[model samples]
Target: MGLVTIAGMAESGDIPMREPLAYFLTWTTYGTWLPGDQRGWVEKPGRFREPNRNMEVANREQMTEPEFVLTSPQRALVELTIRDHCKFRQWSMHAVNCRTNHVHVVVTATGYSPDDVMKQFKSWCTRRLKEHASKPEAPARGPTKNPANSLPLTLRQKFWTRGGSKRIIFDQEGMENAITYTLDGQ
Candidate 1:
């Protein structure tokens, strides 16, 4: 009906696959809530009350590198990329903040799912990051005899995790709260 405000949070590799904090999911008619969760969380559908040690170990084992932390320049690049994408798409971005480990954005785009918006932002930001990383100090005069000496064609490092938190804002109060959190809560 009116402008819909969405809060999207994306984490870096710092957070394990399974966390102690409670996470929620909503279905068509109902939602799942898990309490006092341990290793059997995947079997359940909703909120996990406590930490799962086994899951945490498995997640740690899967780590390819140390926790991915964004530097100040990288964070600034991310913010710029997001703002450019929003402007090109004609979406109203109320606030956006990029931290060392995560990013929070408050935006409104009519007829677009929050998940889709988040994905778009993540995709563009990743491209920008890769471009920055692969840039050469000086332009290449010709193709390199040894391909190994050339810049990498693909990005080996990851900037964002698979999925992120998406919340819908239904009222003015919700929009205000989301903006406040994005701007000040960090």
Candidate 2:
């Protein structure tokens, strides 16, 4: 059924007329933030799972390499990747900030889930990071982050955590908040 808005409702017959105004996506680099983080953690469906110290320890034990922290070049590459991809896809990017441990993005992309958006960002970023890592002149700017980890950046298995925070913003206010948070809150 086609959605009509005359009744001050956004759906009709359980079908939405359009997607949310924007998507607020946040994700961390691999191994940096464990499952049982003291700041809280999301399991699925945006619900917070109970914190468990044992779970955190178990997560740490499963690591094959040190946590991935974005170097200055890496961070810049990531943001550029996102911008390029978004431009190619004709998606609207409200804001994007890539930090050492995590990254935040606010965007409006039709016909795609927030999960897909995050995956695209992570995948492209990984590809770019690998390419950058292989360059002999690529400066290892953040050399102190994981100095003891034996694996070279180029050979690392993954660059990001499996899943991330994806919030659907339904209104203009929420979209503004997301953009502000992505641009300035980090």
Candidate 3:
């Protein structure tokens, strides 16, 4: 598979364009970054909003569970799984970095939509994490404390946010910038 076509509006009689070189993906853990964060937030593509303390407070108050942060081991697991999965899928993995609260990756998956690629990465990472976390040799981490209530978080609690950023890398420069940012800047 090669470059895909970005179809133009059919009713408007638009044509197709070449696909981008790769994708720069970023995702945060659940509850760590709220919608109206002081660091700024995105409502959609090209729709960024100024930081709103009120929005952030409201989002925090409505949380069903406490914010998740990755342990060093967990972060290593995530990063490794990303590379392995990309290799298994035959996707070119340009770069990947995992932080305590988020992850960044640049990859070129020839035939997959960015959303599908992000979803697959998130799904496999979660599965591998859970599998690694569930062993008799290691004591279970016990249960996570929910911020909204007294209930302990079950194993089924969500590990990632609902959606993540998937920016198309249009050229080598963009891909290089993303890779540098992921590997060094953040």
Candidate 4:
């Protein structure tokens, strides 16, 4: 019923700009490194602080210039992936970008939850990617990866890491901020 914005990152954050890496799906998450009681949105760790917490913001304008721009190939693959999946699912894209470490997409789905949309998108995209890829055969050693995660997983486990965080986009101002944040950095 409302617009959705989703973001995903490369596997273990190890994607390089030059190579086409396998598709891995992720939903929004607050930093998992926070304290146990601060795990989800109810805690909002980015804005919250403990008794002895300290914050830091370095001045980058006077520091060394940024060395890399997110590459064209990497950006294009992400863009195409989002577009293809959205089109396949009848979603409308308001804005999106495939940045170096993550991807952001804003869309409206007619008849689906954002979680359902993400699952289908990940399945189709991962299958298509494997179809077009050239990967080495499984190693002739013990205990191969289970084709997803190697660790023992629940049989009914899903692909995405967790439920995505969402905000209600009520007007033009929210839309503008969403677009700007997706295109540029935080």
Candidate 5:
């Protein structure tokens, strides 16, 4: 693959959100574990030849039932939400993929920290999801609670972890890697 030169750079604190930012995000439902090996909702082979253990074969629902992994619909929703929210927030998206276990976003943050950008994105998406899910005639399933809800009222936590893993793309090689990693499954 060749160099993926975005409109701007994915810099650290000094960088802005409007330029270029590549953020790969993975937020779960409460304490729900993702597609790896937490709940075993989607059975896998004990060994390499134990059975068909193709990761691509698994669906998002199977991944999110026990966790809040991105479903196909959710992925589409995320893409649309990203476009709409970015336009509203004046951000730019280089590339975005809603994986089975997490969300990979390659964007441009012209004037915001990765953390702030992610927070804004997550908050906006969450609100949009909540609003889209609410209806007068139908019962709102809404967001699900993790098993951790057994804790006290003050202990009850919200969805998504506190922070995310962000990196700065210094050169074309790194940028290509970031883009490929964001697109192709690991």
Candidate 6:
């Protein structure tokens, strides 16, 4: 009998859903992409030719304010939070970048679903953001429900959309390509 050890290999029990060698995940904040975006848009199962005006209007109406944009400091906070979370989980983080509208991260975490990882990152980041914005010295940027309130107006708003792109990297080449895209393409 022979025993073998494989690098970056996940045990069978670790992954409940489809087991990917690694994951390249990306998600955007709510109201960032409207129905008739010049870059095109996706809603539901099928794709539409023209932007869904009704959908765009509904999305905007649901927002408490205008589109959600992350400030430089806020982006930094999110990126740091993600790095810290990955470190604590002992996951191999290839690359990560947080922009005003969206965030991208490439990581290898066996025994965990991509959705689980995304949720963890989003939840932790949101909590940290709320905490940071609630501080007494934090600068005020957006419209507030109550001027006396402790939390920032943006913090009270939705930070991310429902679902996002989660791609699986199955091989060394795929991992390298994903990492390059995350670090440079973003």
**Top candidate, metric lDDT:** 2
lDDT of 3 by residue, 1-186 (tens): 222222211111122256667888889998888889989987765467999999999999998767777777778989999999999999999999999889999899988878899999999998877777676443224442323222222364778998787777766777777888899996
**Superposition error at 109 for model 5 (Å):** 0.6
Q: Judging by lDDT, tell me the better candidate of 4 and 5.
A: 5
Q: Which regions in candidate 6 have their CA more than 4 angstroms from the true location?
A: 1-19, 44-50, 140-157
The candidate 3 region of ten consecutive residues with least summed lDDT is 7-16
The parts of candidate 5 lying over 4 Å away from their true place are 1-29, 34-70, 136-157
Better of 4 and 6 by lDDT: 6
Better of 1 and 6 by lDDT: 6
Which of the predicted structures, 1 or 6, would earn the higher TM-score when compared with the native? 6
* Residue-level error in angstroms, candidate 6, position 115: 0.5
lDDT of each: 0.55, 0.76, 0.75, 0.41, 0.50, 0.71
Task: Please list the residue runs of candidate 3 whose C-alpha ends up more than 4 Å from where it truly belongs after superposition.
Answer: 1-16, 143-156
- Clashes in predicted model 2: 0
RMSD to true structure for each model, in Å = 11.6, 5.3, 6.0, 14.2, 9.8, 7.5
Candidate 1 residue pairs in clash (backbone atoms < 3 Å):
34-47
lDDT for model 3: 0.75
Please report the candidate that would top TM-score against the real structure.
2
Report the lDDT tens digits of candidate 2 across residue range 78-110: 999999999999999999999988999888899
Residues 47-117, candidate 1: write the lDDT tens digits: 33356666556665665533445556767988999889989998888888887667888777776766678
lDDT of 4 at 166: 37
RMSD versus native structure for model 5: 9.8
lDDT score, candidate 4, position 179 = 68
Model 4: per-residue Cα lDDT over 102-132, one tens digit each: 3566566655544565666555544433332
Query: What is the per-residue lDDT of model 6 for residues 1-186, given as tens digits with 9 covering 90 to 100?
Result: 111113332222243243476877888876688666656675532334467667667767876645666777888999999999999999988899898899989888988878899999999988888777777776544444433332454457577888776666656776777777778986
Model 4 ranges with Cα > 4 A deviation: 1-75, 135-160
